[model samples]
Each structure stands twice: as structure tokens, then as C-alpha cells.
Target: MTKTQKPLVEDDQVAQYAAEGYFVLEKVIGAEDLELLRGAAQFSIDRLDAAMDAAGVDRIGINAKGKRYFSNMVYQQRPELRRFIFGPIMEQICRRVLGENAFLFWEQYVIKAGDPDTTFAWHQDSGYVHENHTPYLTCWIALDDVTEENGSVYLLPYSRSGIKSYIKHIPIETGDQVCYFGSDPGLPVIVPAGSIVCFSSTVIHRSGANLTDKLRRVYLLQYSPEVIMNGDGTAPHGSYEAFLIDGKVATAVS
Candidate 1:
């Protein structure tokens, strides 16, 4: 797709994302791409488990109801992951929503196994990092058909207006950190495999436990501009490198 071409995201959809802090787009991934991603996810999961075992670290708490298969910076480990992270459609969406110069900040896979008691507390992505970038876009791609019974994500629309105070960071056995905030009844974001749910980093969101037999696998990519400030209002060291997509360097503003 050319830079000037209008991507799949329509004008109304962009408006919705701006107003509600999130939007769902369907059929962004084709069958072949989905199959490839599934394979990559499995590979990442196995590698992560082995690494954790070697380190004698269990990132998932012992009492945690469900398992979280996680890997940070997965694109570097599994080249296939780059297909989704820097894919044409994804780049288009990021450029359209975040701006033409938006760059990828991070990529991860969060697979929630079928566990009835496993639920994520309500929180905002921005809460975890003390970054000056007010808001960036998080593209959550469903690797499987996600439903309410399988721990689909729930988002609170327009919650960015009244930002909540950050609570303590909770460490999980998966070697990942979760930030907690005041709870709220969020709207469930249900989408089929190959679909993407885009939300702002500041949007309040969470996922419930997977009560069904199906697993809920989601690949998340966060995009931001070149700079991110620390909590002390200083530039963070070793700043996150932004990957350019669609010939545009991801930026904080359009």
C-alpha cells in the first residue's frame, strides 16, 4: 500500500477510536498469516518456559489460576513475529491512528490458558511505565477466536479523561509486570481470529479468566514516538528504539 493510499481504517473508525479510546478492526490477518503467527507463538512459549526454568524463576505465581505464556521482544527471537509487528496492514493502522511517523515501541504475546479463576485486574498500559509520552496505540491481535468465556479484553471507553492513580506493580511468574488501578466495569472487546483491537495506552482495560476450554492468545504491539520521558521528567537512558513501518517513523503526534 502506498503512503498516500487510504488504508482499511475508515474516517468514522478513526473518529470512533479517538472518541472511545479504542476500536476493533476485522480480518486484518489472512489465513496463512494466522497459521504462521500461531506457530511463532508456540515457539516463543517453549523458549520462554525453558529460559524461566533455567533461571529457576517462575514468573507466574504458584497460586495463579491460569498460565500466562509471555515473551518480551518476541520479534527478535522469532523472525515470523516481525510479519505481524511490521506488517503492511498493521503499519497502515498505526500510521492512520497514531500518525504517519508512529514507530513500534514493543511487542509481546500474552496467552491466557483456560483457567476459570484467572483474571487480570483493571489497569492502563501507561500505568506500568513512567513515560512522558501521554498516550500511544496498542494493537491487540487475536490469534484465536476470543470470547467473553475465554478471557477477552475489556476496555473502559474515554477513561483517559480522569486518569487513575497508579497502584503498586504486581510481579507475575511469567517474568512480566502488571500495574493495578481502581476497578471499573469495562466493556468487553470481542473479536474473531485475525482481527485487531486498537486502544490507547491510557485506556483502562483488563481481561477476565478463561472459563472455556479454548485458549485466548493475543499478540500486542505498542507504538510511540521517538522520545519518552521518565517519571522524574528526565529523558530515560537507553531510549526505546522505534522501528519504522510504512516508510514513516512513528511519532508521538500526527
Candidate 2:
């Protein structure tokens, strides 16, 4: 990198993540990259809508029509998404937060539908896994200018959450696994489009509904030091794809 160009993820931001459990990289994604991600996000939403229509159901697992949508594992089909996924911006953030070796644990396009309004339950990302594992990293990228009203995520830091470790979550009828029922309200993060919120998997977080007129679109990338397998070792819970190894991007990410 040239003298004028700085690292995508700064050392101070990494320090903030260590202290607060999350850090926001504001307006880091470039215009062209943001456009590509926006297009890809729209495509995933459309596909999910069509799938729900064909299935004659508004809900597919945790994805609810006009409320919430989660289109995951698209890189396996949409090659373009891989460009943004493996780009230097993401790789650098993962390298600092998750250490030298980082495996693709999970990826998804999460949309909070507008009008009707939705409220996600407070829970830790690691709570979803049945087995005990080390805390991973979650990179929540905003595809639109996000605010508290536009379905931005609310984070509870380690100090406020008082959760020393991952706890079992109760699965609600809406398919949300809830861990906290307190009235803390959490910290609302507002940022412009193309910002990234790098947080730990053990952090307790949730998002409110999109009270605005448009859908709140976000892309999520998760990484871990090792392959995350199911509790019984039956199968990988998310993915075991090698992306980063020994503090460098993998030569061939397949």
C-alpha cells in the first residue's frame, strides 16, 4: 500500500472491537463494489420471493415474507458475490478480528421488510450452534443507509449484556432463537450505505423492523478459525471453505 493509502481496517478499529465487542467501519466500501453488492442482494431477494410463491407459503424456515428474508450460501451459485466476499476489505477485517486462519463459516443476505415492521429477538450468533465452539466473527455490511428506523442492528456489549458465555436460546414460534428478555434496548448503530459492522459471534444483538417505506438490505459474512461442524459431527453447520490461512489470503479459495 502507498503512503497515502491506509489499511482498510485500522488498528484503532480493531482495538475498539476488542474493547466494545463491535466496531463500525463507516463508508468503507467503494461505489462500484457497493453497486455490485446491491445488485446481488436484490437478486437474492427476488429468488427468495419466487421460491416462496412456488412453494405456496409465505414463510420458509426463518424467512418470512414481507417481514424478514435470509438468502444464504449464494456464492455457491452466484459467482459475482465471491468477488466482494474475498475482496481485500473483508479479508483484512477478518485477519485482524479472527486471527491468521479464517474459514468461511456462514454468509447470507438479510432483509428486513418494510410496512408491517419486524422485530428480531436478542441472541448471540454462537447460540445457534448446538455444540460449544470458539467465538467467530460476524461482518454485517449495510447495503443501504441504515438507521434505527431502517432496521439497523442493535448490539449489547459484553459489559451491558452480562453474558460471560454463550447460553442456550429458546426457539420461538417465529423461528427466532431468543436469549435475552431485558429492557436494555441495546445500542443502535446508524451508518451510511457501504459501512461494515464487525462484531463477535458471542455478542448479543438483534434488529428491529424496517418502519420505512423501503426494505432494509444487509449482507453478512461470518468466519471462524476452524471448520464449524454440527454438534454430533454429522455435517458442517455452515461452511468449512478455506479462505484465509496463516495471515494471508488463500491462494485458491474453492
Candidate 3:
């Protein structure tokens, strides 16, 4: 909590979240925390690259070597990331949006290489679940300036996308699970580094190729008011760790 930090959420943004299913928290990350995130992202990327090399494969699941990598639970590895994860800004955002005791759902680094091939498919965060599950909140934090040409995100609200609820996605050979195939040309998100673009888990969104010469670095964090369960009631869908209780960040991290 620096003096420069603005009010975490606004009335209009909350209203917009209810209506449009998404909102942007502009430049909310402090400079020091932003650098920590960048460092952690690079650290995770290097580790992923090493794992891929050891396995002797250029591609692992959806992670393409030198193209795109999805590194999960990155905060668990870096102490700085742990501080940022349990810090005030994220707690406030989760409390405001979820409106209940918030649980850590999933956190990851989605790093797209410079000028890679066609990237993420048009899909909802819930679409990945592909089964009945509670919709959670996704906070996509930009580690670098994001723009249309540089493979920033594009979102289609539930009202516009027409696929309002969670739907099963079709798997492709390219490793994308796609749900929406229409040509509506989703709304492009253009924002500077340190901004967080928050959206509902059911909101349809995707990103295109990074045509620029720089990597498009995004760290995504998801939170839910309740601990979501996996399909068939097997187990919790996420880490099921309590981040906030009674609208306050838990003193002891689980």
C-alpha cells in the first residue's frame, strides 16, 4: 500500500462488472511489486524452458517452446510474488468483486513470445472447466504495456458474446479449447503495464499473435467467494486456499 495507490475499486467499475462482466483496474501495481512480478515471470519461464528441454520436446500440452508458456502457481515459488499475492491491493479487489470470503483459485504466468503464431482461442475461463462449476473472477495483470498489435487480450461480454453461461469447448490439434467461433471481433484491451483487467470466469476472451518484437507478459490471478469443486465432485477445482476471510486478508497463508 503506497501513497500513490488509488481507491482499489470504484462504484462505476462495480456497476460495470455487474452489467458488462468485466472492468479494468488501471496502473494499480506499485513499481517495486511490478518489478518483482517481472522477475518471477522470467524465472518461471526459464524453468519451464528447462523442463521442456529435459523432456526433449519443443511442445508440452499447450505450452509451445519459444511461442507461449502457461506457468501455474508461480507465486508459490517466489517470496516476492507471495507478498504481492497476499498484499492489500489483491485483497481489496477480491473483496469488492466477489463480495464474500475470497479463496485463491488459480494464478499463472501466460507469456507469449515475440511475434508468435495465432494464440489463445476464444473461450471463457469457465470453458476450460467444461463442466458445471461456479464462475470465478480472473484478474489479468499486465507485466508490460499491452496493445492490439502486441497480442493483448480481447474480450466479449456475456451480453454481446451470446454464450452467456459456461459451455463445453471443442479441443483442437493446436491445443486450444475453443467455444466461440463467431466473427464478432472481440473488444481489444489496450492498457499500460501494471494495470489489471478483471473479468468474470464466464466472460469470453482471447488474444491474438504478438506481432511486435517484445514478449507479451501477463500474470493472471483468479479468485472465488467459495471454494469451487471439480466436476464429478471429486475435489476442489483450485488450490482451495483462503486468501481473505470476513473481507480481510488472512494473516496466515494456508
RMSD of every prediction: 4.8, 1.7, 2.3
CA lDDT of every candidate: 0.71, 0.86, 0.86
lDDT of model 2 at position 26:
96
List runs of model 1 lying over 4 Å from the truth. Answer: 1-6, 60-66, 159-183, 229-241, 245-254
Candidate 1 weakest lDDT stretch, 10 residues: 245-254
Model 2 agreement with the true structure over 1-254: per-residue lDDT tens digits:
57898887888988877777888899999999898888877778888889999999998888887778899997777877778788788788878888889888998999887855477889999988874787889999999999888787999988898775788899999899999999999999999999999998889999988899888889999998888888888888888887788887883533
Give me the displacement of residue 21 in model 1, in angstroms. 0.6
Candidate 1 vs candidate 3, lDDT winner: 3
List the candidates' TM-scores in order: 0.80, 0.94, 0.94
Off by over 4 Å in 3: 1-6, 251-254
TM-score of 3: 0.94
